[model samples]
Target: MKTVLVTGANGFIGRNLVATLSRREDVEVMRIDSKNSLEELAEYALKADFIYHLAGVNRPENTEEFITGNLGYTQYLINILSSNQKKTPILLSSSIQAEQDNPYGSSKRAAEEAVFAYGHNVGVNTFVYRLPNVFGKWSKPNYNSVIATWCHNISREIPIQVNNPDAEVTLVYIDDVIETFIGSMDDPDASYISDYHDISRSFKVKLKDIEACLVSFKSSRHTLVISDLKNDFERFLYSTYLSYLPENDFGYDLEMKHDNRGWLAEFIKTEHSGQVFISRTKPGITRGNHWHHTKVEKFLVIEGEAVVKFRQIEGEETLEYPVNGLSLRVIDIPPGYTHSITNIGTTDVITLFWANELFNPEKPDTYYLEV
Candidate 1:
């Protein structure tokens, strides 16, 4: 079994990575944070086949402050790993800025140097991946990610400013990033044996074109000091392989995330009259797989006969009842009952139930059966 240690595991990128790793059958993902680094880091490295170094100062107010936070902390990590003599393959999560010159980029480069320099002497197999503007499901909301910020603002009708009209940046979806990370597992082709892999995404999209996409949503003509950009989408197409270039990379699919207008239309039709609620029992399914604590539920069987069984946690008392009433056999089930119902009717049965209070959407409040 492959086990991997993921540092900064609670972060925006780390959380998503953790989820992806958890879904893998061959890998066990262990999470580590810097607060517990002294005790956890060494133990984690010893347990795992790989260490993904993602903990660093990706965000800070000033260049000097950011560099100090990033460089100093990574040096600590490198020293610890080097001294431990743990030859685990170290995969460092770097940003495009590491090779660029903004405060963030510079700090990333400095951090990369720490890893690279250490790798040279220790013979530790180190890999650094530079993430471009990554976006998709579970996107982190921060000022720098203009694509998400702008989309969210437009969705909410909030005002947003656009600048650097044509500042080109590359973007890859979370899924593609996952693919790239997994692809790294494959042996490098004979053509490339360079120690440093410039794994930067091939996509280069002009910022203005992304803005141009939002023209339909623009209520009125608003302008920010931006250069007008026109792109030839066909130029980036590659015959053999899918291009990671921006022109080839499609933007986010909106339908994947929300259905606001449809939900709102339904909302407008709903009114507080005769207490409208929702209830469903799956065909060949049961009710009260567990009962509630605060819900004042009235289960009125509307169709075929059904069996309802429950047990009180307070006593060794268990109760079974046959409910076949078209109307008033509606049983008022109080809370603190562990229960389950099995559909025994010849045909699919239906039960209409309503509560005095809204169902607590959280599932932890209910108890279940062992079976």
Candidate 2:
């Protein structure tokens, strides 16, 4: 079995990395967190086939801790590995700030030098990743990532401060980073010696655009409108935004149009495709005695019993299909066909509806007809 050692196993990226590695059948993981002793770290480092040195201090009280945590800890790890005469491949998660001259950057630069020097002296493989702003679930709010802060505040209805709306940020999702890191472990061709690597898939988004996208995600519940999920950036951001929602707020009530007949609520709507909605029909009630020119629809009875009747606009014969919650079946209402559904059972019927186009009151394609 391949033994992998991960430092800072309790941090955001470290937690995610450990969870991912735990699922592998052929890998054994050694997690070393801040509470672990140096003896424990050394022991794990000696036995590890690969070392992921993710431990670092980004928000320390003093500048000395940056050196101690980032630089000193790396030197300590190298000492342990060198003493054991083990040439294990080491992967270091560095930051984009290393190019700057700040204290954090200076310490990171020193750590990078240590890793590169150790690889040179011991003739081992080492990889360093200069990562951008990494954001995703499990990220701590009010820390290094603006995305995390925005998501946390917005989910709680708290106000967020944006100093520079025009400023753009380069963001790499944690999942993408983890995926690339794991792939590097498996694919030797993807890694090189003493060179800085970057996550292949990253997005550059403006601050204002990020806020707008997140706000749209929040408003989607009442509007029943789904953003264009086909775009990769929006899709990832939307997923990340949803992860920050409060646990108690998992379920939201949809606006239902009520009438003496029954009630209908739109569930989800897309820009190009139609919309999905659900409705309840009173017992012995018939609805949708209409035909469409271009729009088509689908009906599926989720609860109770319903008989769906359809007839071609030019034909006199009516077709009927009985559906219920037991054996869920869907009936398609084609264009140029007059269709209607009647609740035949003793109880109210629950049906799911899908249309090919969003209902436009101005140009309603529907015409009154009898089926």
Supply every candidate's count of residue pairs whose N, Cα or C atoms clash at under 3 angstroms: 3, 0
TM-score of 1: 0.54
TM-scores for every candidate against the unseen true structure: 0.54, 0.94
| lDDT tens readout by residue for model 2, 154-222 | 888899999999999999989999998887788756446688888989999999999998888888887
Cα-lDDT of candidate 1: 0.59
Measured by TM-score, the strongest candidate is 2
Candidate 2 global lDDT: 0.91
User: Model 2 off-target regions past 4 Å?
Assistant: 188-191
Q: List pairs with backbone clashes in candidate 2.
A: none
Structural RMSD, model 2: 1.8
Instruction: Show pairs that collide, candidate 1.
Output: 97-105, 98-109, 203-246
Per-candidate Cα lDDT values, in order, are 0.59, 0.91
